[model samples]
Every structure is written in C-alpha cells, then in structure tokens.
Target: MEKDLAPKYLIHKDEKLYFAFAVIVSIIGYLFLIVSIVGFIVWLGFAILSMFLYGLMMAQIRVNGIRLSDKQFPEVFEKVRELCERMEIRVVPDIYVIESGGALNAFASRFFRKNMVVLYSDVFDLINSADDGELSFIIAHELAHIKRNHISKQLFILPAMWIPFLSEAYSRGCEYTCDRMAAYYTNNAEASMNGLTMLGIGKSLFKKVNRREYLLQSSQEKGFFPWLAEKISTHPPLPKRIDEIQMFVGDSSSSAFRRTSRAMWLVVGIVLVIFTFAGIGFLYSDEIEEAVNSIVLDANSITNDVSSDEDSTIMVQAVAEGDIAKVKEQLESGIDPDIQDADGWTPLMWAAQDNNVDLIQLFIEAGADLELQDYYEETALMKAASQDHVEAIALLIEAGADPNMASESYGWTPLMTAATSGNLEAARMLLEAGANPKSKDGDNFTAFLHAKKEGYKEIADLIKQYEDNVN
Candidate 1:
C-alpha cells in the first residue's frame, strides 16, 4: 500500500491525457503518410516531427530567466527547506521570492527546464513570522505539488483548454488533488488548515478561529447553485478548499482515494463528450475549428467582476453602519468577513461596535464564525456588551456566544464589560445566559465590584443574582 502511494516524479493523470492527445495527433499524421505515397524515411520523419511538436505544445515554459537562490532570503529558505525535508519527499523545487506586496500569491511555475516555486515577498513575510507548525505546513504544501507532479499535468492540459467547459472541470480537479497533497505532507490538520486560512480565510487573530465551525459552514454550501458555481470556477471556492483540507489532513491515502474517484468520474464524463464531438469534428474539421475559435474569442471579451478588495472595504463599512443588506451583498460577492482593515477590526467586530442586532444576525446566518476574536482578543459578544448594545448582546447570546470567554491581552469578559458600562438590561441578559459574575477584569475587580464602583445599582443587582444562583 505504501509503495502504491510512492511519489512518482513522472507524468500524472493529466499528463497521461496530454500524451494521449499527442498520440492521437501522431496517428493522424501516420494516416497522412500512408495516403501521400511518400518515401519510408520521409514518412518516418513526419511521424517523429508530429511527436516532437506534440510534446513541445505541452511544454509551456521555454526559458528559465528567473533564478531561485536560497541565499537571497536565507532565513525563509532555510525554514522552507527544513519543512520539505520533514515531509520525506525527494527533489525539493527551487524557491524564488518575487516583489508582490499587493498581491499575495504562491504558485508552481515550470515554463523553463527547471521546476520552481514562486512566492510573493509579502506572503513570505506574513507566513514566516507565524508559529512553528504554520511555516512547515505551508512549505510542505508547496513541496507536495512538486512531489505529485502537478505542474507537469497542468502544462499537459493546454489542448483541452480549448474546450471551455471541460477545461474548467479539469483545472478544478487539479486544485483538489494539490490540496490533498498539502494535507498529506503536513500530518497536523490544524497546521495545514491554518496555513490556508492565513493565505486567504484568516486574520492576525487566526488562533481563535474555530476549525470545526468553519468546516461545518463550508459543508452547508454543497447545493445545486453552489455546484453550478463551482463548475464555472477556476479555483474551488475557499470554503470548499477548507472543507477538503479538513477531510484529509490526518489521512492522505483516504483523501487521495476519494479525490481520485471523483476525478475518474469527471474524466470519464469529459472523454465521453470528447468522443461525441470528435466524430463531428472529423466529419467537418474546418467548421468545428471556426466555431471553437469564435467561442474562445467571445470568452476573452467578457469582463471579470471579481470585487474582493472593494467588497472587503464595503463589508467593513456595512458592518460599521449595521447595514444587513449591504453586508449580505458583500458576503455573496465573495468578501471574506474575517478580513481586517488597516486597524485590524474584522467585520464582526465592526458590527458588534455598531450595536446592530440584525446585521450581526446576518453575518451569523452567512456562516461567519462567531468564535473568531479580533486582534485585541475580544469576541463579538464581548464587543457588543462593551458598547452597551442590549439587542446585540441578546442576539449574540442566543447564537451560543460564550459569556465566560476572556481576552488574553485584556482579560475581560462580557459580564465585566456590561458591569463597567452600567447597562442593567445587558447585564441581566448575560448573567441569565450563564455569565460568570465572579470573573475578574484586568484590574482584578469582580463583575460585582465593577458595577458597584461604576454606581450602577441595577447592574450590580444582576451580578449578585448570578453569583447567588451559582452559590
């Protein structure tokens, strides 16, 4: 079984398809050789020429102009190298750091003879400073691409890309396979998942994001609309990728088997469609080419409506204003709710401060993980109560907000927040929902003492009731 999974540096499934395409083209050339009555040697030359051209078509990179040296960024390169070694894979690809602060990206580029991994300088900086396992997981994920021959297969799919729908399906399958490979290289699921989160889904306070809750949220998007959207996508939606990582971090073989099965079915479907169209193409090859070209040209004219950056800013504003409709629009537009602005305030944090109960509910309904804390270690519940938002407090409490949760930096809880604010209604709701009245704040004052000192007699009464209930 281990041998079966033994990494092959050669052609992968997609690469095999490329070679099939090459063979098909070569067979057609040989048939021409028979019809033209050419000399045996000339006929052989044409066949060889067809084979060479086919292979060259799959080779997307022709020159190696970029150099990847570990010496350029010794610290990051050393860490990445160590991580690759830990994964037990041979042939670690060269690492190149490029100038891209605005665009955070990492990709396997193999246009030249040498296989390479190019990481944006900002991306390296963001991830390199992370905790121990995070750096390793990220590096391991990139190496998984090299070990699995993903780049080679990607190059092989160029011909199929002419078929718009099939090309989309093939590209998506490749992403899932690479995601599985990343999980395989890092035995730690949290590390692998967190790495992806930092790349796209997480913020600075990523440590508090509940992995289970995020996975559950992703699982709810497998409906017909989601499926149709996925069919037209280049990358599997971020949540689906997270869901895929969660399913396979501990067990690569299982993940690989499941992915392979799904890929096999997709490939079978594509092959059937190709055969159905191939006969048509053979009968009227010129007309088919013209039609395919027209479709491709029209596709190129379509404008991309991706609004990740604009949507992020709008989401922050909507949260600040407690605008449920605008927030929902941004979420559906693919803006990540957990993203923070220059001040490090997530959308949830902004909504909590705005004291908008309906907007907060909208975020929760859109699958925003409520457990995620801001950079200050303040959860949404804590934020709402801190600002004396009674309705927001009630909504958060009903949604399973942990009243006892304390910020590591500030060491404050919801009860302490309500006590300091002197909001009797908020205090009563929190206490009734199991807020620990005995919990102390940064000043080491219990909720009861905080309320009394703030001259809030009604707030103090609520704290006393909670204390009395427990006693």
Candidate 2:
C-alpha cells in the first residue's frame, strides 16, 4: 500500500517571485540598517560584495561539469543519467567531488544547461561502496532534488537568506521537500529511510548499531528544546524526516514509524500560533527588540572568539595514545607537532611519555625541537628517562637532544635524571653520548647517590663502572 511519495509541490514554479523576494529582502535589510547614513552605506557595500561573490560561484558551476569528467568513479555519472531518465527530468546536473570537504555533504547548484552536484569525498566514499540498492536509492534522491526543482524553490526563498529567522525555516523546508522526492523515486519506504539514516547517522564499525534504535533515538529528540533547535537548522530531525516518508507511503503501520497522535500536532500548532503573534508583538516593542538585538550580538561575538584549540589537543592526545589515523587527521589539517600547548608540552613530549619510539622519530622528522621542555624543565629525553622508557631515550639521543644540557628548573642533566630513576638502559645511552655523570641537581645529589637512594642496583652498577673508567 505504498502511496506516491513524489513531491507534488513545484518548489521553483515561481522563480520570478523568488527572484523578486531575494532582491526585496536584500533591499529591506539594507534599509533597516539606515539609522545612520554611514550604516546604510556599509550595509549596502556588504550586500553588493556578497551578491558578487555568489554570482561568481554560480558562474563556476558551468565549468564544474567539465571538472566532473575527471572523476575517479565514472559509474556515478551513469547512475545520475539513469535516475534522471526514470524521474522524467529534462536535465541531469554534472556531478563533481569537492575534495576539500572534510565532512559528508552534497549540494546542488543552479545552472543553464544542467545544475551541478558537489559531493564531498566522505559521502562519495560511502555511496560508491554501498550495496547496489543503497547506492541506487541515494542517486535517485539527489535526482529527485533536481526533478522537483527544490534548489530553485530554495533560491526563491532567498529573502530568508537575509532574514536570519525565516532563512532557517526556508532551509528546513528544502530538506523536507527533497526527502519526499527521494521516497518517491526509491518506491521502497525502507530504502528512503536507509538513505536519510546514512546521511544523519554515519556508518559504524559495530554491525549491531540498530536502525530501529536509531529511529527511536531520533524520535526522542523532538521534545520542545530539540524542536526549537531544529527551527534554526536547515534540515528536519532524522526521526521527523523518517516519519514524513513513512506517513506519505502508508508505512506508518510499523510501530517504529508511528508518530505522536494528531492531538500532539494540534497542541504544537496552537503553541506556534501563539508564539508567532508574540514574536510580532515583541518586534514592535522597543525594549524587547533591544534585548533581542543585544543577545544576538553577544552570541555572535562569543562564536567568533572561540579559537580552534580542539584540533591541537586531539592531535596531541592521539599522538600520546599512538593512534596513527588521528595523527594523520591533524597533519592533514596542517597542525604543527612542534606547536606548544599552554604548558609548552608538544606532541614529542607526549610521545616520549608514552614511550612511543616510532612516534618520537616521526615528530623529530616532522621538525619537532628535540630540546623543547615542559614547565617541569623536562625535555622529551628527560620525560622518557623518568618513566624509564629506554627505547624512547635511545631515539631522542640519536635525534641529537643535548645530553649535557641541564633542566632549568631541576638543574639536572639528562644523565643525572636517568641515573636517579634507575633507568640503566637510559643511563648507558646518555653516558655513551658523553653526559657529565657528576652533574648535580638543586639538592646537590650526584647521579650515583640518587641511583643508590632510588634502589636502582643495575643503574648504580653502570654508574660505578663509568666512575672507575674516569679514574
């Protein structure tokens, strides 16, 4: 009993109106900033610049088709053509991968002969390797976007691009429309569900990650707070989207697909209606409007100020944990292993502590300063020695870290620290590198005495052997 899921609504039927609105909204936004002549000019200048940039991007879509011709997977183009035929679409957009996209994403651009589809590498890798059913269904969904002219409809709502509040609504509507088109072409309700799930929920290594559980989790996310957040997003919540397809295709009979009762929608509608009027009233209220403006300004300022520290921290921790893949991500993002954290600890320091000799060698080759020290005046070698990481000690010594250089805080050479900790292997390596065995610390304790106190018999024996050789 699957019903027609095709988007019956022609999103772009009124392109002229949409174009008019884009222009009108741009002008209105500019005018709104006209409290001062300087503000008006600034606003107008920015609007013009944005329009020009977007125009340039649109112009590039023509060449995008040529660029798509060089794709690593030629089969994608064939799939696009087949889907376009099935959907009775007059044009199939040239598809290309934006290798720069580090996340999963796909977007369609308007063009003269054909629109353009820019698939991120992440998404292409997923779809290209999927089973035939999953892969074909996904292609159909993208085609449905073109067939229903969803991209044009979104362009028609261009005013929302200027109006932040309405812009969010416009974006979400586009997603809903595309989902309907996807379900229409896939025909199987489950296939459309699978496509949406893939987009929202990335593939997991654990095969037991249940789709039913995922749909349930998505459903629970539609409470008041979550729905409010969705209002500001360009896409519907995954559960709501899944429900939309299931409802359209008469698949709601599944317990997992059944939505909250009609009464719930009624209550939500009343609440929304009330809030709409309330919002209109508040916009006209000087005090409320001022408060809203202040909040917006503060939020924007905060967002702009939060630096990208997570990239470095994650890289550092991954290096410590000996994770090659995570290290690669940071490197790909142009992270510097030599870059010191707040405590002046670099990836080399973490590698030393973890006794990761290979990673130590890697960081050294990547231009890590072998002499860099932490707040504790511990060089990577010192850290390796204190933890008795013999292999790491060997790598650092080979990397030419100065064995004679004493820590500024502890005033102990690498040899003194290694001897005191009873790391005989580290002590032997440092001594061979011409370390001054007699180097003393703040406590005036020599490497020999420290080794005795730390109960390092083997290190003590090595130190005595060095002493005898000196005599």
Clashes of each: 1, 0
How much lDDT does candidate 1 score? Answer: 0.61
Clashing pairs in 2: none
Name model 1 segments beyond 4 Å from true. 1-70, 83-92, 222-225, 249-471
lDDT of 2 by residue, 342-441 (tens): 5767789888989987788878877888887777777888888878887888888888888888888778788778876767778888888877777778
In model 1, residue pairs whose N, Cα or C atoms come closer than 3 Å (at least 3 residues apart or on different chains), thus clashing, are 61-111
Clashes of 1: 1
For model 1, residues 1-471, the per-residue Cα lDDT tens digits are 111243432123432332334223434544655677665567467657965775474343223223345656566667666656765653456676666646556676543334567666655666446564665565665676665555544433334454444555556656666665555555556676676676664436567777566655665655667666766776766656666665544333333212323333244344554454444444554353344445433542232122223345667877777667777777886666676654556687788888876777777777767777766777888788877788888888788888898888767888887888877777888887888888876788898998899899888876787788786
All candidates: TM-score: 0.41, 0.45
